[model samples]
Target: MSNRNIKVVRVTKDDYDQVCAITPPGQIYSGTDYLPDYFHMLLDMSNVEAYAAVVDGKFASFFLSFVVDNGRTVVTRAGRTNKEYAGMGLQDVMRRNTIKDRKYDKMAATSGAHVKAILDQIKSGKREKILMMEFRSYITSGDQLKSILNTIGNTTPSSAKPIDAIELGDILTNQQVSCHLFPESRVIVDWVPYRLIKSNAFLIKTIRTTVIGSNLENGTRILTFGNYFNTTAGLVCNIEVYGCIGETLAEHLYLHLRELISHEISGKVIIRCFYRQETKSNFITKLMNRFGLDITEIWGTGLVCTETTPEIYFR
Candidate 1:
């Protein structure tokens, strides 16, 4: 039975303003929402599909699905709705319609309270937990960076440097980097998870991110993928870290922080870090103890703190 009040339809560039304008609450994934920036790019792709729930002749919610990992999975993102239509169930209606059209397995990446909602949905239906990672968001400023700068104390930065597309693709494929750094051979980029494959690495290049990591050599571990975007909350410094936990990981984090400081990133900086669960305590511990600051601080409000991002499969 079709509901006369609402209908799900594929979106296009013409729907950009309607979709991007709907700031329901919190954010889509994390950091600055790439939805507004990359929506057109997604629409241009033949394999990608973005759908919106038009309720009573108005765009109510938006969702995007992109095939990845040799078409084995469809990553669903850019999920949100208008606060005006909050209890209307537009998001669910749009998501269900979109999933029904997808032939491959589906994945939903969410955090904090949204993660629980996704998990709850999975329990009721057919969904699998692909991966789980911890996210720490800290509001920092230049003054704060100064306070922590002294704690590092004559520490030289690691060999971590910016790599081009080719180099990044190569580094991600390194056996050690893929096995140890990446959990289940999945690389988390800007909070979106992708398999440990060169193709995905190259795909990220379109996002124009700086892949910072060193060449692995005998137990060596280092990987930092970071990119910042303009937001009302100030410059959002979004990043993901994949490295050996504890001291080594802390050092790698500092390397990114130190590099960030040099750019003199203006305004309140929301430094969001995504890392594995087992390493969070020790990693943040050493980071604070060594650098006098950490992203482990509780997010007061405004943004939803997605504790675990689980990818639910439709197939």
Candidate 2:
């Protein structure tokens, strides 16, 4: 009993208005740019394949599909022409993405040698689990959301050492970052071995992290920031920090970083927070409770976000 058209397909430039209907305003508020640009970039990358739920032949709802970091990871985002799709009791739109997991994996595997090579590299890595992070808005009030979130904590692996053991560091480099030609910049480390690009296009800036202490504690803070590079996507910028801290510090750092990057870069910034290892710590649950970050249950990774875009380091 779906109203309006629901068709999932590769988006075209012409579909801007329809897609915008579901997306937030142009203001870089919340995580709007992630999807709109994601659509265009998908088309540009040609590595992206979209699927929509077309009802009545109109684009009622759509999900953006892309394999990033050379095919080592698959990311999909869904939105509807009307906001109803994301409302309570009607979260089916969010659920639709889970159905295509295997399909996308197979697609990435069969697409090109680059993906194959990336897979081989991942297979060789010592890490044993996949990590998935989802940054989304909090639909319900804090109390209710807390109840729901506590039930679903950050994604973690079943058979790995806990998050407490891993060391965390914030990396920032003042070195001149290199920018590859458009599109080529999207080349990832995993794709390097397969000849995807001459080499990893992501410009690595040698960043220095001020080692605060060796102990993994909850109150420590690490702040990282650097310049952006022109890639297939818009001017890419990154600000990241990793330390054993609570959600308050994470949110505080995220907020300050977002303001910092936004003031500096007129364009949109996609900020990403990466945790080193899995943590079943109540700290993760507390972070989820405070911030809107969601643990994408699909891949077992701890990912949080702010209105910031960190340079994508494929390696």
Candidate 3:
């Protein structure tokens, strides 16, 4: 329990179970669910570097970072501290130590306190530039879903089909193009490996649909992924939409989402958009407002700090 007894060590395959055992259950930090199996996968990844704060050989906190954009960036995937170890600053210690070994050009993260912590490091003279502040929009209601649907007007729905890595990669590329061209576009940083996608996809219970004319003559596709769980607040549906479709099509896609998952929507439907720059926040905020869905902003920040600037690429 003493501060001097705590030590930060590189996490190994042997530490997987202990790490998960100490991870706080449900919404561990910034709405991120603690997935033990996923944690195991991260531990096994050659590109991922993980660290843990241990006291007397017991896990207290953990942090994970992995190469993204083909080694151009290192992203902090998740960090959590055991409630029993609260107030010890274990999370900060793990983050500091893990990042000190960074071999990549840029570092990125997408959690509230963690983002602020990274910013503090930059402010303290770490070579870094604030790329953007990221935010998410949460919507929960059938009425609002309907309103958004009506606002978007008629949209042709494409057949439901599973998106392969190739198609997903193309969609992400288009997303990057949209981000560069549109002043109001929101960009999300995703660096997940192809091998891990299949396993994680199962937990999301996703619904995929295409919106005609949202992009070019080929149109755009929307992938809405989430799950419903019973909580004290009631049965809540948390959904995340991916694709670079414009605001109108984004709303229309949500309508199709409601149709596909109506049985799962119970007390509330919490829809979350990927992390977007502050400049593009208005596009999503306005859409959610028009639909009467309450909005909560999940704040995150990104910094570009590489010795040699690397070419930007979507991951």
Using Cα atoms with residue i matched to residue i, what is each candidate's TM-score against the true structure?
0.75, 0.36, 0.56
lDDT of each: 0.63, 0.34, 0.50
Q: Which sections of candidate 1 miss by over 4 Å? A: 1-5, 24-47, 83-89, 96-102, 142-158, 174-176, 246-251, 254-266, 280-282, 285-315
Candidate 1 per-residue lDDT, tens place, 218-266, comes to: 4666677776665555556666767654455655666666756766566
TM-score of 1: 0.75
Worst 10 residues of 2 by lDDT: 305-314
Q: Candidate 3 residues 1-315, lDDT tens each?
A: 464588889888887778777854454534445345355655656667888898777898888876556555566676778788788878767766765645656655544434555456556544344334344546566555655666765555444444444454444456544343222332232322121222322212222222222333233534533334433333333333444535544445455355535554445555444433434666766766655667764323322322112222111
Best by TM-score: 1
Query: How many residue pairs clash in model 3?
Result: 0
| Candidate 1 colliding pairs | 111-306, 112-306, 112-307
Score candidate 3 by TM-score against the native: 0.56
Q: Please provide the root mean square deviation of candidate 3 (C-alpha atoms, Å).
A: 7.7
lDDT for 239 in candidate 2 is: 30
The Cα error of candidate 2 at residue 301, in Å, is 14
| Regions of model 2 farther than 4 Å from truth | 2-5, 26-32, 37-39, 68-73, 77-81, 85-129, 132-238, 241-315
- How much does candidate 2 score in TM-score? 0.36
